[model samples]
Target: MPDPALLSIKDLHISVGSRPVIEGVSLDIAPGEMLGLVGESGCGKSVTALSIMRLLAEPPMHIDSGSIAFGGANVLDLDGPALEALRGDQIAMIFQEPMTSLNPVFTVGDQIAEVVTLHRAISREVAMARALELLGRVGIPTPDTALTRYPHQMSGGQRQRVMIAMALACDPQLLVADEPTTALDVTVQAQILDLLDDLRRETGMAVLLITHDLGVVSQYCDRVAVMYGGRIVEQAAASDLFAHPRHRYTEALLRTIPASNAPGTELPAIPGTVPPPGQRPSGCTFHPRCHAVVDACPRTMPELTGEPSSDSLLESRRMSLLELNHLSTTYPGAKGAVVQAVSDVSLDIAAGEVLGVVGESGCGKSTLGRTLLRLVEPSGGQILFDGKDLTALDRHQMKAVRRDLQVIFQDPFGSLNPRHSVGYIIGEPLIVHGVGDQASRDARVDELLALVGLPPDAGRRYPHEFSGGQRQRIAIARALALDPKLLVADEAVSALDVSIQSQIINLIAQLQKRLNLSILFISHDLSVIRHVSDRIAVMYLGRIVEIGPTETIMNKPQHPYTQALLSAIPRPGVARQKRVVLQGELPDPTKPPKGCAFHTRCPMVMDICHSVRPVLEHPTGSPTTGQVACHLYQDQA
Candidate 1:
């Protein structure tokens, strides 16, 4: 029998400049198994992957002591020439940002062919032919036509696919993928993920996937290694980690995920941010922000120990929400096309929920959010709010219903009128609804401002006078003015810094509990999505390809498109997905896919998939809330 473990990283100690980053870090990857190394940005996950390949820039990164053993040899000890031979021939890597990774002047096909030439003694013609074949395999459309195109000519997803083809050209035993899909669209993301899944199963090659998204690791990886600062704080089976997280950091990470089941309030985010490497505390690196931190946490760092495992989720994950018949709006083109943004798309939101919508520009996620609030004209489809059909209410008749509905838009600056002061901005809802008069509105605005943690005098400041975080607070306060039952946050906090992001997330979590408001939050940041969404709907060119409870969707995403979108989220560690480097921009929405919208660049495309549309239906092993539209899962055979 073959030894399952193919690569081992042991007691690695790495330092950059004058500070230590990775200390006593260790993990293993068996053949065909993926080990996800996850943490926030600037964590040591990237350094660890680079160290295995001996790629870190010297001086700043020095591996003082460590052992990276593969194929009975210590790769760390190998000299330049030996390491050079091992680099592309045995262990390969796909870095983040394909546009910059490739040589600007080289044709994409030539770049891939160059890798084949380096590892094997092959004629230029033969190598180029092999390059074309690999590109085709990676889902690049019209490989022959694309050979002459430079990296600049290809879209981000296409460029990434070229990078994958180059990495796979040598067929290395071990592959390290870093943020391979972060730049692609939701539909494209799903396709790339499915391709990675197919390739992993076929080659049985070990993959070290690095990312910040717990959802990605839960979906495509077998094992998980949680990172904090530069240390491996926890490691466990993917399912076990989700069901019963061991570390305090891991628990906090779980709470950060926004859930549709959670009423629209605030997300319980891990307080504070990842400290810069040099500023990391003396004892436990996570102590400053850990909610359960104790005195020992500030005095001694705890070793990662395996905890009791719960297999309940190992059998099957649970479903928390379901959307049956759904319809939204659409405006087809700049001219002739009728914009039926959302039509006949039924949706459901449940108890303890946070339902998320993800789509590229103009895919109707925002429109759908408005429709839920009856802010737009709905052409058709039943909307089940809890159990009631919300469309039945008449315009003036629904005035009472407006108190329960609230929305937060993408641009915090534009969303809040500049003419109004921060206090007035928030109190507008109270005044318009006649919930309170001048004195009462003033008092209520001050109360809401304090609830969001702003000072009482903040009411006197104009919208422009406050910072981005403060402006967002004003927006949140206004949304809360109605004391609503549901809220729709549309790209509400996309522009804030990472540290501020944590604060807002924490505030939202706190507010949700204080006021039970179901939220329809929408955004493009997958990292934020993994943390905030209880359930997610992946929209492509105006159709949801996959929808399910967050954990279920993250753990076993069925649609290739959903898989690709999840795979694209960037994290600090765990190698990235290789083959699913989706190679095309979203098809022009005006002229969508003839059948399956994703088929144009799908890796596992079938002839039938092009001729017939796949229905969004339930799969047997999926959670009840999970709905996917893909030919791969169909019972056609």
Candidate 2:
């Protein structure tokens, strides 16, 4: 006979106030298995996780119907003490944000000890010892001294580890981690995932990992459930789900990935955005954005039933608008020291090509974008636009060039003036550039709003009045107001939800094509970078460590830094593969390592890597167009 499910939800329904948020959701997880729950933001992924723990605030949320069975007991029917017992003893959950989950006033060790003391009936000293042990097990260095440190004193990765330790204090049979690694650096994410998998194997615990990153879901999850509009659109083994996703939403999500799309092609972004709660469409919620939508789709919902299969196919195939020749930017530090933000970074963006620069935070990805736009003055090297060296130009000359070299900053809220209407904000650029009179600028503003898919009347709305996606559209329209030839989009879509991110990505692609615009897209997200970039440059410690076509850099990464970054990406549906977990945080730019900056954490470091800098060059017999700055590839050439 087959083993019974460790946890099972049958026809679950949840309501928030008068609105239904989760409807007819059913899923199961077996013992010692990792199940992934995936969907875009506000798609009930976190709500589902909260439901499993019965952690929802009763006043605002209530389970209307359904049964949550755990180890033959209906968890929904458990009494207060019974539910309390079940919480830390049999089931534990790690919340999405560590900073918010943990109390700032409490020491991390004390927090974990509280869980242990509550559930285990252990003495304070014993619980404290247990907490320290857990901290050590979770890979925190100096676990002994770390016991006294508050959550605020720890780094993001360290704080997350504390949360995990607290959740595992009682050795619960089931662990629910909701977007545990979201917003974390790729290397830290890899480490956290590895620790979770290791702990699961050691303790024989089942893990339900809820995240929007399909790549992460592919690598760490054993079974997968694709959730949309409060329903399980599809569920299957990881391999089967990735191989052949039957649901159109799933298929669209898969196609939206950078790895799935070929370089220099338009990303296959799903149109529109996920409907707001209480506003979902009748019959099928995803019908509006689905490319496979039919007449029946809007009137009838389809059952998710299909066999899984795999397939692979590939198809192939610039006037220089902006160029950088060994461009460098530095800032004076506290004691005669200097912070190198961009170091001898030489690259170029063609007339209409997107050159994506990707790296971890503090790796100077944003600084490079700012440098190219001349927002940050270069300490050395040259910034050339249309064969004219920008560094040699005076402030007045550079100001004149600003009309054709615009920027879209990461935070649309801060970038856009909240006090001003969209019309005034966009027209301000035109006014500054002396492109048109007030009447002409107003007409141009309306035209620009239409170009970014906003309503003609949207110009009257303030920045705060629009949604995150809409605000981004406003930002785009403003950037296009001057008919800029080159645009610097620095982490433009990083703050948006996945579905909204796709829309903005598509909008950028459309604008690029329509305006014949050259773009310098800077972000820490490799998947998004791969999706929109013709060429990619991997940066580390203020230097371009690797540069190549998107496909070449992604598929055949020659630099160790590039390889580690790629390996750290969570590929949903693919089983856990060998990955290089980079050690330590990004080094202080003021005191960067003497040689190759990445050598501090690189897995394949050599003696020379510690003393001598490497030059970016193509490897011998590579047969691909790209460059790698690594000592390992030096011999290959």
Candidate 3:
């Protein structure tokens, strides 16, 4: 016999100011089970999770219908005192961003202990002791010292651990984790997910994990529920859902993932964006973008039913356009120490080729990009673009050279001026470079906007008037205004939703091919990197660990760090691979390890790795025409 459901939601209907948000949604989470609720942004995943705990604000948000029952008690009907007791006691939540959720004025210990003291009648000292135990359990290093530090003092991974510890303080029967690892690095994300799985087994608690990442859902959850505009489109066991997805929306969503497509090929992006809440089409909300849509799809919403569905060579003959010869960047740290952000990295990109730089945070990929563009002055080595030494150029000379180099940042809105119209934002580069008069520049702006798939009339609107994907398109138009030869995109698509991300990615790829442009694509996501890049360079602690053709690196990575990164990525519709979990967090940049910076956490580290740094070279018996820096290859060579 199976256990009864710990939390049950039946035909939930949520509304914001008479507009429907979540409609006819039902889900169940049994004790000791992990269920994943997935959908794009504004699809009511979070609202459903919030309603489970009565966390939604009233007036603006109201439950139009349905019931959420936890352990035979109706959560929506609970009074103030009962609701307070229900929260953080039998049911707990870990929000998306821990920095915003944690109190800035309080220490880690004080914040965690408050949860304990509020839920249980425990002394402050005992609560603090329990907090320490949780910190340790969640894999935080030096828990005794961490308890006294502020949220900002610790790294992102450590801060997330603190949030997890606080959620587990009361030993809740159910845990609601909402996009908890979305902003984390791949390795850190793996660690957090593994920790949750272990804790679930030990505590026998159910988890409702809400995210848009199908990969994470496939790897972690036992049961999966697919959410579309305000409704449950499909629900099944995780394996069954991935192997035999019946919903057209689910099938299209899977197609958008880069892993499901080939390298340097156009991704089959879903046509339109998710419609806004009061403006959704009559019948199926996804019908507008569905390739297999029928006349009936636009008039009738489908019922939830059981379904089954299916889902760069760097070393070539071309001349190099951009070359980095032992480029380095350093900044002064506390106590007169120098932080090596980019260390002795060397690489080249050919004309019309896309070179991807990938690694965890603080691995110097962004720094390398900025340094090569002269945005951040290099500390050593040379940047050669088209046979000209960028490092030796004067300020006036570099200013002229800027016409050929441009960059697109992660936050499109942050880079764009909210006060300016789209026309002015895109034409300002032409104006600054004195490429043409006002009329000609205005004409160029319209052409550029059209090139990026936006209409000429979109120029009159401001940045805030557009969606996230539209804003990114505007940024791309601005970056291409000068017709630059080299484009540096730094984490450009990391912030958008999955469907929107696919749109932007396909746009960039098309532009790259159409314009014959060379791009330096920097991101932490290997899957995205694989799709757009001809070649890849893996970085760790300011050094390139491996460089190779896209297929070679993905299929047969030589370096341990590269292998671990590849293993950490969650693959939809594929069985979970044995992850090469690195031991500890990244080391201090100001005071890196004596020899190899990765030696401390590498799974295949040897005695020589502690004293001698390995040179980047091709390993014996390997089929890749790539270079790797590791003693495992060096010893074999």
Candidate 4:
């Protein structure tokens, strides 16, 4: 016989101000089991998770009907004291954003110790000791020093680890983690997930992981539940669910993952966004956007059913549109130390080709992008654009060249002016370049907006008036206003929900083809980079470790850093493979490693790697094999 469920939620119906947010949701998590609850944003995944812990605000959020049972006890019926005891002691939660969830005023030690002291009758010294132990367990380096550091002083990954440590202080019977890895890099994300899995096995605690990332679910969870329109549409074992999904919604979501699709191919994005809480359609909330919608889908709701469910580079031999010849960008750090943001990078983007620059945070990918456009002045090396040296151009000359080189930033709202209308924002480039009159610019704005799949009248609204995805579209329109030959898309779609990300990615691919524009796409997501890039460049500590055709790099990465990155990517519908988790955090940019920049964390590091720097070259002495910078590859050539 199997063990009783550690956490059981039945017939949960939650409403916010008379509007149903979660309707008829039921889930079960057995002891030591990890259950993934997945759906697009606003699909009630978080609401359901919050309801399980009784964390929802009272006035706006009320449980219409439901029961959450933990160890056969009704959580909904608990009084104030009982609820307080239940929380942190028996049930702990790790919220999505650690920065906000963690108390900013306290040190890491104080915050974690408070959880221990509150749950257990322990002295401050013992609580502090426990906090240090938890920190070490969660993979935080130098736990003693980390305890005294403020939340703002640590990296995003470290902050998340602290959050995890605090949650596990009491060794709760169940842990509710909501999008814990959403903002983390793939390497850090893998480490955090692995830590959780390890701790679960050791402590025998169940986990309810709520995320939109199907890839994470496929690898970590024992079972999966699919939510849509505030209801559970499908639930099954992870393997069974991925292999043969019974629900149409589940099938659609699997198709939308960039890793599951071919390189440079258009993603089959679900049409329209998720309907708001009070504005869901009559029957199926997904019916309007569902590709496999039937006549019955719009009029009749479907029951929850058991289901088993399941880049080629640009080939055109065009001339180089942009060329970086031994490019380097350096910034002066504190105490007159020089930070090597971009070091000795050399690459060329063929006309209309998409070159992806991928690495973990602080790897100099973003700095490389900024340097290419002269937004940050380079310390050395030449930037040749269309046979003209950009470094040689004066301010006036660069201003004219700016019309041919434009950029799309990651945060749409931050890049856009709140006070300006979308039309003005899009047409500002034309005004700056003195390309057309007001009437002509307005016409151009409408054309640009239409090109990005936005309605013509959308220009009348401000940035705040539009959704996140829509705001990104406005940013794209603005970038296209000048019809640049090259576009630097710096983490373009990383901020969006998965469905919306697909839509934007498809739109970018479409526009790239239509305009025959070269793109320098920079991101930390290897999966996404593979989907949109013709060629991939892996950066490590301000240098390119490898550059190759997307298919070649994805299949046979040569550099240790590149291999580790590819190995860390979570593949949906597939079992987790052995990952090469790098042992240490990124080295300080101001004082990089003596020889190979990645040697400090390289698993295959040798004595030579510790003393001699490797140059980027064809690993197998064949141009077609691509360039790799590593001591191991040097001998292979």
Global lDDT scores for all candidate models: 0.75, 0.85, 0.87, 0.87
Model 4 TM-score, 2 decimals: 0.51
TM per candidate: 0.49, 0.51, 0.51, 0.51
TM-score of 3: 0.51
Candidate 2: C-alpha RMSD to true structure equals 23.5
Over the stretch 1-637, how does candidate 3's per-residue lDDT look in tens digits? 3556678788899999979999998787788888898988878899999999898998798999999889998898899999999999899999889999999999999999999999898899999999999999999998999999999998888889999999999999999999999999999999999999999999998899998888998899987888888998877677756764657788888888888899999998878777777988997788898876644457666555222111011110233678899999999989999999999999988766799999999999999999999999999999988768999999999989898899999999999999999999999998888887888788888888888999889999999999999999999999998778899999999999999999999999988865557899999999999999989999999999999989899999999999999999999999998899998889999988977789999988888889888898888666678999998887642
Over 64-183, each residue of candidate 1 has an lDDT whose tens digit, in order, gives 998988987998889989998898879999887888789998888788888888879999999999988988999999999999899999888888788778888888888898877767
Clashing pairs in model 3, backbone N/Cα/C closer than 3 A: 244-309, 245-309, 312-534, 312-549, 312-550
lDDT of predicted model 3: 0.87
CA deviation > 4 Å runs, candidate 4? 1-317, 621-624
Off by over 4 Å in 2: 1-319
How many steric overlaps does candidate 2 have? 10
Model 2 is weakest, by summed lDDT over 10 consecutive residues, at 308-317
Candidate 4 lDDT over 31-131, as tens digits, reads 88888999999899988988877889997889999898888899999999999998998999998889999989899999999999998898999999999
Could you tell me which 10 consecutive residues in candidate 1 have the lowest summed lDDT?
312-321
| Candidate 2 C-alpha lDDT tens digits along 381-408 | 9887876789889899999988778999
Q: Per-prediction count of colliding residue pairs?
A: 66, 10, 5, 12
